[model samples]
Target: MKSLMKTALAAAVFITASNAVDLKVLITDTLKNNQNLKADRYYQEAKQKSFQSVRNIYNPKLTGGLNYNRLDLDVRNTQVVNTAAAFVKFSMDLYDGGKNRALKNQKLYEYKAQKYQNISNVNQTILNVVTLYFNLKTIKENIEVYKEKGRALKAQYERIKSKYDLKMATQEDVLKLKSEYEANLYTIEELKYQKMQLIKNIELYSGVKVSRLDTSVIPDTNVKYSTTSDIKALEENLKASEESINIAKSSKKPQLKIEDTLSYYRYSDYNEKLLSDLPDKQNQLNISLTFNIFDTSTKSKVESSKYIKLATASRLEFAKKQAKTDFELARQKLLTQKEKIKSLQSAVDMANSVYNTVKIKYENGLVDNITYLDALSKKIYYIALYKQAQNELQIIKMEYYLKSGIDYKKLLSLLK
Candidate 1:
């Protein structure tokens, strides 16, 4: 049944849009279009019905029938007389090994587990959607970065051509600038394609078209610059997993149940009456108990659940170790990007100084355009490198938030 629903959802959202829409709008539409959400809701509702399914008082049944006695003896002028009876009987289950009660508990726990599972699913879906959103955001920023570089290079290319016309600049410089401009254009095009692919992923998952995006902001979840935030969340997850193991273990014990029954009946006779006893309004009562001493097949499930719980604990431990490593790596990477930014910032300033001074020299015919253009190009490149350095810093810090469990809404709030 679930596989069929998933297939339906797949067919519904299979097509990608011709163009992208706004991310938030797309999310809203996707939720509306999401057949999977509806399926989850239906399953949850079915689980809720289990509450109403708790064993209830079943009413006793009353039976009625008619019959004729055959006696050809010449009695009562050989008359044909009618005979009828109205009787009530009570029935109850003696004991089915406490299976009903156990079933009820199983259903209850299953319902609860499903609720938690749904919460986890929502969290994961939000993560995927937000990741795609930010992925597009990153690509868009890179596109702008390249566009800025292209602008600078285009201007330099024209200046070099002018210098070449004056026989003051080599063809090599002009060709280099042209090649750089083309490369920047190509980079921009690639970034645009990447951004669209991110949008395509969002559409496939959310089942909505993405039209526009608010890229003026970025996520800045202020993670407690602590040493053990990820560890803390992992610990919580482990505890929950442990409790789940307990729930599964609870299933192995034999179940016990108690039951009772009661009822009444009415009667009448054809031609008033011909019976040994009248329909005697009767009452009934009963009690039952049962136990299952052996089921080798079920033991496997208990063991499997236990092993999964234990594995979760082990995974948490591994994550703790990985977090420590990431902490050190983040520290090193951020420091490197920072030092590089500082170095290149100074370089840009010095290059700008040189370009200005040399521009003065060129105007005075003391030097040529080639020298001035080279200095200008160096300054622009340094500025571009500085932009990359900033992005690298943000990436480093983003790790801190992600490790701290910065979810979509929280991340969105930070971006806002």
Candidate 2:
């Protein structure tokens, strides 16, 4: 009997290993096909383009205009004059109290912040996929446990029915067994439905249909916490806000700019004869410095920006604290799950021993059907508990890895 049990265990292990799916492949596919991630990629591209646009603040701008005029005088009501002129102008910011440079830096920092945010989004989506995959895997395993219990109940029911026919058991015993069997069937059906829903959720997030998942993938539970993408993104945001303060402060300084224009003029012979000394063509270069001696709004804007910078700093501090709290919580939960798994494994062993003893006594007619059935139910319940605890341990480990910001590829490499 021990040899047979060992053979069965070995076969189950072989089946599990044979059917194992590569977690790396699944994660890669999820990253490629997830709609939210694709949308975030487009958003990141937009931010990049905005950064490029901001960097062109010093580029020269060209503008052109044309004008036509008609003039009449009461003293010369019968006479009319027409004039036309056109001009092309070019202007660029020679300096704006460094506001342009600060604004450009702010956009660049914002783009960096956006990139980190995208990374955070990707990580969160991957975490969700991993969670759903494992949940489905656990539910599938639970269904098998329920089926095993059903088989045991069916066997017991048949034994009781046979005993009733032989006048050794009462109708009550047969009826009780039948009811338990039906209940087990109902439970199995419910579990199957739950498994289907999990599969649907996984498909929605990953854009891939999942029929099976391997629970053999283990992650390092001893990893230390590192800077998560959230924290980095917040840091960038704070820097960007600081740059904005500089931009606002720059508004209070003098602005120096250069303007250049070239123009052409034409007049009818009648108008030219009336105004003889008018120049027909012109070119001009002007350099101007303007200072805001007492702008009422600049002070208010700078104060508002300083307050925003303060708020951003506060948020950064809060985020750091929250990340640390999450890391510690996940770590503690992992430890607690490990302990639960150990205790439940011992309970499973004891329950199996009791079930085997009850089965022997029932076969020898030393115990009643109800007592035997109860022992068997206890054994099945403990087995399910052990399996659930094992699954929870894996999930907690994954959570720890995520909180620690460990590379998912490294976690995937640990799969056996």
Candidate 3:
């Protein structure tokens, strides 16, 4: 009987209806159309550009400008002089004590960290869509079960009423049927409310209307995992913090810079002849080396950077521990849910068998109406529990994948 119940429930829950929406397709659409994910993409692009912007800090800079000057001299001969010049300047950092290198590496690490963070967010969004989708499925199924029970109770109540009218049934039996029917109706109403809430949540995450879901995909429960995105992000942050320490220490070393300027000058005829000693075209190359001679803050800055690196290292370790803990917890939960479903499945089958027997006995006047009603109620209750456990087990499977850093959508794709 338990095996028969399992087969029947599996057929009922796993069979895909013609009009049902595929979860894999829904998740894909949600990822494409979700507004929050779009914003995250934009932010990640901005971070990538920032990393690119700092990559060429060692490249030379060239600039050109025009200048004009007018001078009046009344000291000796009251001479008036006018000059115009066009100059091009080229400058490059010959050496920066590895500051540019460290800065560039820091930006690269920051970009990588942000990229992993975005991946983490994507994982979360997929989980949200899947969870809501499954929750709606469970609530809808439960509502239908309650409605079926309600219909059955209503029919029973009407039959008892007819018997009462014929003076073949007691008033107590009729009243019990009516009361049970009303309670069944109240349960249906409550389940409908839960279904409505689940629908709204599903729409919020998937950005689509809720309807029938295709529950054909059954993911494997054997958990497989890699380093999670959260851990990767934290590792990148640690690297960035180390680079910051490098950048801070670089300030204590000497820096060398080189510059070259070329100028073409034009002057008034009188001034040109009077200042013939200066050439019409001039070129100059300059090199300078400088260091922080007496700054008290450099040591403090480096020490601060070191502390930050230590903090980031600590965070990375904590994240690793937390990820492991979460995965183990999810695994335990999945195991427990499986056991619960096993137990409830047998209970549902037994309750159903008892209800069928008691229903026949009651109709033949061999059993009390109270015994029949209790059997009916127990059957429905066990069926609801069994169905809910099955749906929740699916959620646990997905969460197991999430904790292991396995992509749940890819698992869904295996349904094909």
Candidate 4:
């Protein structure tokens, strides 16, 4: 029997050790496989391609074509004529009133903005995963507390039942103990359901089935807020919007382009004599200048672009303020949760001492069953509360880290 028990205990220990996952590994896996982050990366790549396309807007273009014509004339005499022509044209925009440059700048800023946006998405996803992971740990700890309470209540109920059989304890006492045990059992079941849901949510986000999560990781509480990706992305967008305004303004300026064409023609008919004056080969070069001097549409577009720039500027300001506000709030919550945890720790210690004293007295027949049960329940409640506070404190720390723009990888590295 002892050998079997030892083997079972060893197996349980081994399973627990094997299931334990580091917080850093969990976060790294989440970043690698998260669908939303992958989508954002793809979007960033597309924006980069668009930026490159914009830079090549002024590349030279070459075009070639062939044409055939046939004619029969009966005016002076019967004549049959056929013509075949081939032409090659090369064209390039030498100047576009600086519009192309502004467009390229806009796309460049947009691409940068997308890169920062991806970073922001990653940060948010990390926050969600960390929060959910810790929440599951908290719920599981609470379940254990309830289970312990249930066990204590069950032992007390058995003792009371034995006393009632000897007419030493009342039936009411036995029923009360039984009721508390049942209630604790119900609470455990509810908590287990909650844990199941949390596990599912974590699996959905991290793309892995997590059997155990390490809660020993701690974050630096002294971290301070700084510029985050959200603010940077908005700043880039503002620059892009400003470039749009410049592009619109440039549309009113003159456009200059150069074109060169080479042509060859062949004629094989009776009308060749009449068409002998036509050149068999020709080359032409042309320079064109176009200016929209009286177009109301260009003016309207310029005004619209300016308005959009203003809006973008407003959004940037708002983002900065929001980031600051979030950081302050998270820091404040962290401080509050820290204090709460300290107080709950003290309470738990006191509750444990009282429960131990009451249990000894009840065993010596110096205290009633109800008193012993109350002491045990108090200990369990305080313990559960303390664990919950600790979990909440960790969550707030994570929020503070995220809001402060601290690198999550660095934060995870601090885990020990």
**Candidate 3 residue-wise lDDT, 132-232, digit = tens:** 87777888888889888988888888888999999999999999988888887888888889888988777776788767777644567565667999999
**Better by TM-score, candidate 4 or 2:** 4
Best-to-worst ranking by TM-score = 4, 2, 3, 1
Candidate 3 ranges with C-alpha deviation above 4 Å: 1-18, 57-59, 70-83, 170-175, 266-273, 276-279, 365-369, 407-412
**lDDT values for all models:** 0.60, 0.82, 0.84, 0.85
Winning candidate number (lDDT): 4
Residue lDDT tens for model 2, 116-214: 898888878777777776677778888898899889889988988998999988999899889999998999999899989988887787787676676
Clashes of 2: 0
- Candidate 4 minimal-lDDT segment of 10 residues: 72-81
Clash totals in order: 7, 0, 0, 0
lDDT by residue (300-362, candidate 1, tens digit) is 766776787688789878977887677667656766877888998898788779877876786
TM-score result, candidate 2? 0.87
lDDT of 4 at 143: 89
Question: Candidate 4 overall Cα lDDT vs. reference?
Answer: 0.85
Off by over 4 Å in 1: 1-145, 148-180, 198-222, 225-256, 259-275, 278-283, 293-305, 316-344, 347-382, 389-399, 405-415
Q: Candidate 3, TM-score vs. the true structure?
A: 0.87
The numbered model that scores best in TM-score is 4
TM-score of each: 0.55, 0.87, 0.87, 0.89
